[model samples]
Target: MKLVEITLDYPYNGGETFCKQELEIAEKYFDEILLISMSGHIGEGNIRYVPPNAKLINARKARYEASVYLKSFFQLLRIRTIREIVFAKKKLRTKESMPQILKEIFIYYYYANLLKRVFEKEVIEDDDILYSYWMAAPAYYLSIKGKKALKVSRTHRFDCFIEECYQPFRREIIEGLDCIISISEAGKKSIEARLIPFTSCLSEKIKVSRLGIMKKSSATDFGGKSNKYFTILTCSNIHIVKRLDLMIKALEKINIPVNWIHIGDGELGEQIRTQAKVLDSNKYVKYTFKGVLTQQQIYDFYERNHIDLFVNCSDSEGVPVSVMEAISFGIPVIARDVGGNSEIVSSENGILLDKNITPKVLMEAIRSILLLDDDKYINLRKNAVRKYRECFMASENYSNFFEMLISMAKEK
Candidate 1:
């Protein structure tokens, strides 16, 4: 079968490190592959771990035409435009960003036209597949036109959470697609529930497909740790949603000294740095902002260093790949119970805090792990490794997902 995968920006730039591995795994399932990305960053590195025979296309090059805008405006008017306008007023909190919504609508219309042109030019067959990386705007837009190819979309947190998008996400787009996959059970539930407005039977169309990580060669040794120094590691784009401030504040409240390591960078990098200095003034917390590191660099850090625990205080998430990476290396996680985090963390493997977590709650969770006896700590480490092997290992889950896709394609 031929596979045509679409992403906002995966193999073309930084972020979505797991996507590189996903693309590589997908290569084995299809004889021919074409990767389509809406946009990409130019500078640093190639993010795709694709096979040598695959092709790449950037759909972002679709030029903006006034005709396309006019067409999209009329299209929006026919489908939930009034509701979207109301949603924008209530959710966005500003009229200034309404233009952004219009811009997205235009982009989506442009992409649909672009895909139609690609189908005409490249001659996509009925048996070929169009797999969208996210079940949001792109998938919705792409499904607006073409139906010859089997359409599948993987719905992550942002797409599953309707409030995250200002415009009312038309479920008809998803309903028309052949299959919809969710990264977590929580996400699956949300997606299924959202479809009730369209059809009662549509819930069965959404399936839970957990994201996986490559297992480490050897599990991290839990025995040897410096009594004086405890290291807490977190990997994510430094953003307000990540709530890095909560982590810093929690560290400040803790009596035990901590070395906090952040492995990613973003617009909030400088703000986080400034806050880190303020917390480090009394010497209770020492922050190391490692900027952005490649996927190999992250694995190397896990291999060479003794990271005591992994922490995630994000406001929201799907299934976090960074958490999977940490547990694969036998590091216990302390993540807020939001989104799909509870799927990975539990009483046996790691700690889960309430969604509305404060510094006191976070500090307590951290101290509970830190103050555990050696045997208990080692047990947690063992459980972490076991969890990764059973649930999050790449070989098992990805292969099963690929087989499912092949079966679905044949049925179609």
Candidate 2:
């Protein structure tokens, strides 16, 4: 059977990870695979960028520039490429800034033509299933209008709503599909909360699969003189949503001599550093701000470092990749019992903070996890590895997962 997976094809984002991991799994089962894309204006290769894979179609005359995003309201409204060229040329002749309208118009045509190519030219005419890796206008169009293949839409639910200005074409397109995959049960609830209000009935097309990471990640050494203090690895943005502050405050409250390394960069970077300096800059709560690294770097760090526990502070997630990576490495997790976090981590494998995910509670939980007897740590690690192998292998779970899609394709 023929199958194709399409994403905006941006590099190094969660959506990119989903696209790559799921595509790799699909490649093993399907005969034909097509991944189409145009250059997007995000961090080129930093945050989540990947070396080009599958099929790449960078349509820009040159690399994307900063001016592209500053389109005018009028241009944004009546966005058309023909009008954009005229607008840009007129602005240049007058030595004035191009209105935002021209830029918006350019992007509209950019995406439209890009999708036109993928739908009309690149995709195999008789593909059995056309999978949308991320929910967006392009995917919505293929799902709703493409007559050649069974359309499948997977909602990451990051912002799958019709906001004040941004139209949610993606949700509209997934209305009637062979499958509407949800990354987490929380994501499913978000769909029900946002979409169910308008409609009375929903379909079983909605299915949940926790995100996964490369199973065997290389470790990074925590480069310290001695491994005396318990090393905890906290991976997430240092933002209010991630609650890095809570982790820092909890460290202050705790009397134990522990050290934890932070594994991401975000708005809370400076604030968390200040908090750490104020609390105690000693080895007791050693906080390292390893800016966003490559996916392999992240794994290498985990492999080399003595990361005793994987702690998560985010308030929201589907099945977050950090937790999956931790489980895959047998590091276990200690996270707020919120969102799909509770679904991935269990009492047997890790400590689940009650609703009170405060500094005091977080401190106590860390102390407890670190203080676990030798047998307890071994058991937790053993059980977590077992869970990863049994329940979360990409090759196995996704085979059954895509098999369901194939079954649905037959019905359609």
Candidate 3:
């Protein structure tokens, strides 16, 4: 069977390097694959890791044709756009960016037209699987493409949450797809909860499939090597949702000498840095922002540095891969309790703060973790490692997932 995998951005960007490992595992199941980049960089400076028997198509380069848009516009309207508009007016309207909403809708229309041309020009086997990384716009477009191939989509944070969508998933689109795999159990529940009111039949098609990461050979011990000062780390795009400012404020509350390191940069990079300086005015904390680094560099940093505890203050997440990566290094986390975080963090491995995580709450969590004795700290480290092996092992999870996908694609 063949697989056509669509991603927003994967190998070409440093952010979603895990998709490369996913593609690597997927290569074993399918003879030939089509790797389509919905919005990945294709310039000379960018590097892409593609599978052996796969073709790469950077759809970002494709220009919009008026005829394609017109055809797709009508098709989209038929797929519950009118109903969605009504729902949007009544209630359950999305708070996401207007430009982002427009972009998502346009991308689906663009891709639907693009895929039609590709299918017409090429040979697509009946047993092939059309899988979109996210179950938002792409899945809907793929569903209406009128292809015999199996259509599957995986739901993540933004795509799965109705509150995050300007226009939530259409009932027809969910009914149309062969299967929908949510990255977290929480995400699956959210999808089913929304779909059940409209049509209970679509609920059966949604399934929970957790994300995984490659395990590491060696991991850092709990409490780090030097107990004199705590070294806290966070790896995420510095955005408002991430609430990095909270992490900085928490550090300020901790009188203990500490080292704070941030691995990624984003919209709030400068603002975060400015706030970090203001919060750490007493010099009790040493701040180091590594901007953005490749996954290997991040892992290497973990290997070289003595990181005490990983912290994630995000308002929402879909079982963050960064937390998994931290777990791979035997680092316990202190994360805000929201959107699949409880699946990863617990009292045994780490602390989970309430949704309304004030600086006091964060400070207390950090302080309590820091106060752990050797025996307790070691146990926490062991639990982190055990959790990774039990849930987030890449080889086992992805291999099993692909097998299931192939079986579904082959189903008559």
Candidate 4:
């Protein structure tokens, strides 16, 4: 049977590198794999290599026009929409205004209908697996239209947590899917807590499937550094949630020499750069912005250079793969304790700061690491590598993921 995977933008954009290892494992299990991208298109640059058995479909070509919006507006009158509105009013103590809720519902139906039309043309079979990379519109559509196929979706921070994004018809989506896979135990718990108002049995379908990375050929040497400056690396889309500005502010307060290297770029890139200019006056704080790099390129950077610390000050996460990559190379992390960050990072491998981490608090965490004796520092590096092997090793995680998929397909 075939396996159809739905993604936002994989094999086209720099984002979703986490799917690369999982796809490699998936290629071995499914006879035919269809990679349908909801937002990916050709000539966007940095197109990734797809597996031999998989076919890439650029669904973005089917642009949503005024007609789609009109259709969505009409869908607001449907019984399902009304039921969801009633359910939300009774169960959820949402902070969103009525207009905001209605707007989100319109957008939801618009995308769900769009995705339904996109998949309608596909050659799906009864025993095939319809997997959504995110528990968003693709999963919502699949849950409605997946006929005898096994409908499954993986939830990340933004898609899984209501606080992160507006999830329309959350209950119905959970009810429709055969299984919902979360990237972290924290995410699984969150989903269960949200669904408690509906029914406890829905929680049975949820599972904690941690994302993993392939082990590097060699771990970074703790003492092998050409430069004397303490190197700090942060890799993520320069978004408001990532809090790059806070990092810059924190580095500004530190007295010791530091070389901060940021990987990846986003809408806030220019803004963050302007904010970082303040650090230029401080000779002790030197920062570099390495624009968007492919996953291999990031790993190559790790191999060639010695990174003293990796820091993630993000407001939320679903066990960031960037942190996993850093720890794989024995780089100790200093991340805010949010979402799955606590599961991967701790006092052993690195410092897990509180969620309400300010610039001053972050600076103190950095100083704490800088103050560690040679033996203590070396132990932290060793622990970082050990953590990567035990929890984030790709071979064990992805193999088990596909085996579960294979079992579900067979059972169906």
Candidate No. with top lDDT: 4
Better of 1 and 2 by TM-score: 1
Candidate 3, residues 1-412, lDDT tens digits: the string is 8899887766566555668788889998889999877663556366667999998876655444677677766665554545555555455555655456555566666676666665576677789898988776667778777788888898888777777555445565678788889888888898788655675465778887777987455665554435667888999998999999888878887787778889999998998988888655756778899998877788888888878889999998999999999988888899988999999999888998898978988988888887788788878888998899899989998998898888887774
Per-residue lDDT of 112-170 in model 1, one digit per residue for the tens? 66556555667578888888888766687656655577888888887776655543344
TM-score of 1: 0.90
How well does candidate 2 match the true structure in TM-score terms? 0.77
Error of 2 at 243 (Å): 1.9
**What's the distance in Å from true for residue 13, model 4?**
2.8
lDDT of 4 by residue, 142-202 (tens): 8788489899999998777777666777776788888999999989999888864585355
| Backbone clash count for every predicted candidate, in the order shown | 1, 20, 0, 0
Which residue runs of candidate 3 sit more than 4 Å off their true CA positions?
60-80, 91-104, 200-202, 220-225
Q: Each model's TM-score, in the order given?
A: 0.90, 0.77, 0.92, 0.94
| Candidate 4: count of backbone clashes, pairs at least 3 residues apart or interchain | 0
Clashing pairs in 3: none
- Residue 271 CA displacement from its true place in model 4, Å: 1.7
Compose the digit string of candidate 2's lDDT tens values, residues 314-333.
Answer: 76555777787777777867
Better of 2 and 3 by TM-score: 3
Whole-model lDDT, model 2? 0.62
